[model samples]
Target chain A: MDAVLSIRDLAVEFKTDTGLTRALVDVGFDVPRGEVTAIVGESGSGKSVTANCIMRLIQPPGRIVAGTIEFAPERALSSEGQAPRAPRLRAPPFDIVSLPNRDPRLQELHGGLISMVFQEPMTALSPVYTVGNQVAEAILCHRDVSRRQAWRESAEMLERVGLDDIERRMRMYPFEFSGGMRQRVVIAMALVCHPEVLICDEPTTALDVTIQAEILTLIKDLQRDLGNSVIFITHDLGVVAQIADQVVVMYQGRVLEIGTVRQVLKDPVHPYTRGLLAAIPGLAPKGQPLATIGSVVGDADIETPHPLRRLADGRQVSMPQDSRG
Target chain B: MRSYLVSRVLGMVPTLAVISVIIFTVIQLPEGDIVSSTLDRLQAQGVDVTEEYVQNLRAQYNLDKPLVLQYFYWAGNFLTGDMGYSYLFSRPVNELVWERLGYTLSITVSALFFTWIVALPIGIYSAVRQYSIGDYVMTSIALVGLATPPFLLALIFMHIGFEWFGVSTGGLFSPEFEDAAWSWARFADLLAHLWLPMIIVGMGSAAFTMRILRANLLDELNKPYVVTARAKGVPPAKLVLKYPVRIAINPFISNIGLMLPGLVSGEALVSLVMGLPTIGPLLLQSLLNQDMFLAGSLLMWLAILTVVGILLSDLLLAWVDPRIRFE
Candidate 1:
């Protein structure tokens, strides 16, 4: 599979007054080109941090101590196409870690080459800006267009995102729209620039159960239509099974399993993966409480001391390919 | 928009009416008034203090009437622009007030203008570089600004001005310009003398405003939308102005109602120290001497500013914050 992005031996730490706490250690994953790569981990497993790190959006007190996020050459990224244009991509991958926070290169990539959709739609949108203004602003940031043109394009994007009555809705604010509609607006903004990679940081976690399905379908449909790679960060195993082409199970900032969704779900290897799969109630026997990770690994085992540091010191422990695959 | 303006203007009537009653009644609620004080002053000067003369004076001044009747009499004449006579100045209250009002507005409004112009950029910079050395220095200066009293600052500036510039540092205009006719030279002299007082009055308020803006902007800068905006490749300056500035300014804009009242009485104590012929000290003197018309009219003006300021702030908030789909 063509890797659009590669994260190698990623280690990040948060320095508080008390001491340093490792948030992500020896975390590595490849987001395959034109596919949804799901990183499933509970809160504090650094799934969200991984996405933020890719965008170089990590703020103070938390720093990426060791890692290199290599983004594929921009030449391969088409400005416009149904499928990503198959041009000969000759330029070397850009090292995202080395770029300064406000470097023009990084700014160009952000919202232009690589965009992100956040989890909470309520706070994600600025209250002072209209739906159309925000989307148009994103376009105006990267594409040099007059305000009128940007707005027209934004309206088209809104219509594309399943928001009808475009002209009126464009002028409306976030509070005017329902949660589902707001999320769609955010989606339109992220896709407006036709970014090559869209980071979905638990995009539907704050959504209603019914609306969540619609958003997920919308994202999948858009990814297909736009031909952009997606890094879907979530803790829902069911969501992973449904949406992800490749799955990476992370626990305590360490990658436990990485393979196709079917391989990991049907024939799991890692003990943590087995426990997580078994914890699903549907897979359990009838007339009994669901088996949980705490039951399988025990409470003490889940917090296994330095499970991340056990392998090659400061080197990636990329798992082998399955013979079945 | 028209309805909003109509409602706001319509809303001011009852408010001003209530304030008028309170203004008249509160002055009387106090034990002694202009007559008693005048009587006291007369007796202190060893003049013949007589019940008969006191009765005559009270009757002449309409003080013998009921409080409600007194209020109606004052309100009736006031509504017709005859703002009673200021016995203290021996002139009509309307003439006394409007004359002093120009001097007061020049200082207070300029102070306000200076405050906003200086405070906004400093506040923005402090928030953007929070915890940096520049932020620390700016924060320290803002704290000093807040802690130092405006009157104390005025006194210090006066001493410095006299010692350094050999110029008398009190009042709105230089000696030659005080009663000079409106001329280029007089205007120039006023400009030379006006800045010191403006700085003294404005420094305290500007620093206060800066700190508020800084704290509020810091809170907003860390918000999700700010990060989202940054992610959209928005330049750093535009990102800050677009998202955090607009949100942070809600509190600042809301403060306009309070600040507008300050335009009248912002540095009453400071203006007193500077000996500037502003209305603030005049308001105090009128209250002390029980110059009912002058004090009441001034108080009414303040109330009007407050009501109007609040209405303006609400309208401005609706304009700035798109979230308010004001029906």
Candidate 2:
């Protein structure tokens, strides 16, 4: 299978007054085309940071130290014989770490190829502008559309995201909309460009359970229609079980396991993965007390006498990834 | 909405009445009485001044009545738009003050326009480039502007202009102002004379305004929405202008209400230093010689400006931002 996006040996570091704090280390994973890939990890496990790195959103003092992120060149038109095409050929799978931020190809990747939906819907929108105007603004910025066409497209997108009274609500400010509506508006904005990849950073964490279900379902349906890869970042195993086809378990900043949902669920490989599965109360055997993972998250020390080393069985037995990374 | 407007206008009535009463009562005070000043001046000139002559002079000026009665008489004429005569200027109070009001407003308003134009971008840029050397230098200049008073700044500007730019310190227009047609050259001359006063007042207030805007923009930049926009793959320039500036500038627009009073007060001081015929020098002269009508007329104008300024700000808030509903 062709991997749409592949990340290898991805390490991220942040400079602080104390010292360099490694946020992500040796992170490796691949997202195939038209699939929902879930990065399952608790907060501070660099789940959000990994997504941000993909979108080039890491602020100052935090940066990708070493990594290779290769994305397939998005084909604008199928080559029929030797017909002439646009002068700018699509960017081939290149190391995102080495790409200059201001490069023209990099510029095209942003907002054009990848769009992000943040967790909090209320804070994600421009408060001064009407919800409709803001979505239309994003469309106008990315697409070659007239103002009238942009507005119409924005309204249709809002409706597609399951918003009721899209026209009336479009004129309303974010404060006027409910939490679910705001999230829908955000989704509409991100999907309006019909990007090749959509990175949802804890998209449903702040939402209530019912709204969470709706948002997740809407995202799944949108993905099916748009045929774009979705990277879902969340810590809840339940959410991963419901929506994720392939799961990448991250402990601290390292990927612990990468496999199909059933493989990881039925036969967990890593000890940490086993512990996480055992810790789930409902997943335990009937009438028996729920087993709890003994080790605390983020408790691993990086400077201990010995790091986790491979065992003789060739099983690579070691402590879980260090949270201090 | 109509009721709200009516209530706001009605509230101003009591305030205006109180202000008028205070002005009228203070002018009718026994110390430095109109009759006494006239009699003293006549005696000093070696003319035989009598109580009857002084009393007749008081009657002509309507200073013979009780303070309350005289206040009503003046208030009655005032509501009818009769500002009475200015004993000092020898012209009608409204005529003299209104004529100068145009000149004062022209310079003060132009300076205010410049202040916003210069401050908004500078302040936003400084905040966006926070901790950079450019930000540091801009902030330092703003602090200096804040530290110097408008009049003092005006004095310095006047000195500099006279010494270096060969700019005139007196008159908005040149000596041939009456003869000159309304041409670009004439307008340019008027603006040249305005430079010293404009810089003095504009820089003083614009510094504070810039600081306020910078603080506001910085606060907005820290907001999660701005981060969201950046993470959404919006270009840096678009992200800064669309989300940060649009959000941060709301508070600054709201603050226009407070800035109005400062504008009126600053106009006086800036006009005084520039030797422009604005309410500042006019009010100053009235206060020195105790010309009550001139002072009262100017004070009322200031009060009116305060009300109008706040109303304009509210309307602008509505126009620029749809989130704010008047109801």
Candidate 3:
């Protein structure tokens, strides 16, 4: 019920030499407080675009055409019914989309109130700097702590992220770490300031199955411990089932279905959503041919407006107009 | 790090040895040694060619020895700092080389500094601004600098100095200070004339380095790490400098090895045109007159400098980038 980020009618467009192409259109979702909201989609499904829009990090030629990404940090930060911690920015909910790129308020919110864990842990970190230096830099960016204090805090954060020998590991470069270890360091960097909302953009997609499972567990455990909202963008249904409290299925830059994990996974209404569930490899009978979804949604289907119909179970599914009629 | 340094220094020995063999063979490949060229000059000057005198000259200079033995004698003496005699200059090769080396080093070193100082900021600006008017203008100027040869630029500066400043800038010193003792005034005169050749020799390299840096920085600017830094709310200036620029500067550091030899040889034409007393022209003269020891020693020194420069650059590269260091 309590939403930390309420994005409404978000639209983003990329200007290519060919013409303007829609990256996202009429996309809206709420990331509730102190819960994992997994956004599932195939590649090019605007999952990353939504994440970038939330952070206001869309580069040139890709601009948010319309949206209100309302971030109420006060609600997210104080939801535990205790006094808010230090480094808290006490402000009313503000539209992140409307804020200028260099607005001091928006910058303060970045890496402090709303931080991101990028997809590629290998390249997401600077190679030249030591892990300790980078993590401390994140702390120093948001909080007015002494350099020594920041290093100490960074060491503790690294320890918290399941890294062994924090002292020695901190001095090592990112390239020195394994993929899973680098992802852990990245998580430490993201959560160093104890941000209210952590946007993880496919954090485990690059790791092996075992490491992926470990990282997912680590994230879930940390989320439970830290009590911060997490927007987990992933295409793996298994991962969404394992970690997500709520689910948002996106296709062609549009949110087709949004509901609680059980509601959407067990009782999905949209044909596209049903096709996605059927395409899961595990659900197919062993030794039989894996059932594949035919092309059920087309360009015309996306272009046509399909109003979201709320089912009795509180799941919202957008059905094609012809099927609904 | 210490082992790396030691191994690198030790590695240069075999490289220099192979190079020395090549240099000796190549220099010998040209017909006749320094003695014949000296005798030809003498004969051209109407000096009578006597058999006894010729035999004495051959025995004294070891001209009659086998080529392998000749190579050993020269190489053996070279290792002991006995750079053999210069038949053309009629002086010890060491004296002639050492004299010019000081001036050569001063010009090359200062020009290197000049190139870095002029190129780095402009390169950073061009990359950061990318397509802005300032970037376009800087790029145009850099292209022009790249296109113009150093000798022509030297000639242009000479004419400008003579016509506009009412001062001749053909050498490293004014006429009065040409052979004078070192003094504040002589140094001042040297400084005034120095800029012309420095700019002439440095322009092409500075333009090249700037374009390299700009392109490297442009590539780094789009990397995921740069975007990560930006997403971390790093301010634009600090983000650019601390992240992308640091990585972009690796190529420049790696280029130090190539740059040293390039600047030394590149200064040759400019030095010839300007008539500055540097090794370029000296090397040129020794090579032309078949002065074996002098030419061979100069080439050897150039090889040594190249090896040392590469070693220094590798060390600096490792120091600047931890990835290279750990590897």
TM values, all candidates: 0.92, 0.89, 0.93
- The best-first sequence of candidates by TM-score reads 3, 1, 2
How would you encode candidate 3's per-residue C-alpha lDDT over B1-327 as one tens digit per residue?
Answer: 888888888989999999999999999898887668768888999999898888889887888899889889989999999999998888999999986887787788788889999999999999988999999999999999999988999899889888999977787887888889989999898888788788888999999999999999999998988877777767788888999999998988988888988899889889999899999999999999898889999999989988998888889999999988533
Candidates' DockQ values?
A: 0.73, 0.48, 0.65
- Which residue pairs in candidate 3 have backbone atoms (N, alpha carbon, C) closer than 3 angstroms, thus clashing? none
Per-residue lDDT of candidate 3, residues A161-234 (tens digit): 99998899999999999999999998998899888899999999889999999999999999999999999999
Could you tell which candidate, 2 or 3, scores higher by lDDT?
Answer: 3
Clashing pairs in 2: A22-A325
The predicted structure with the larger DockQ, 2 or 3, is 3
Best by TM-score: 3
How many pairs of residues collide in each model?
A: 0, 1, 0
Report residue A11 deviation for candidate 3 (angstroms). Answer: 1.5
Candidate 2 per-residue lDDT over residues B63-144, each given as its tens digit: 8887778778788988899887887877889888776787777766777787899899999999989899999999999999
Per the 3 Å backbone cut-off, how many clashing residue pairs does candidate 3 have? Answer: 0
Judging by lDDT against the true structure, name the best candidate: 3
Instruction: Tell me what fraction of the real C-alpha contacts between chains A and B each candidate also makes.
Output: 0.84, 0.48, 0.60
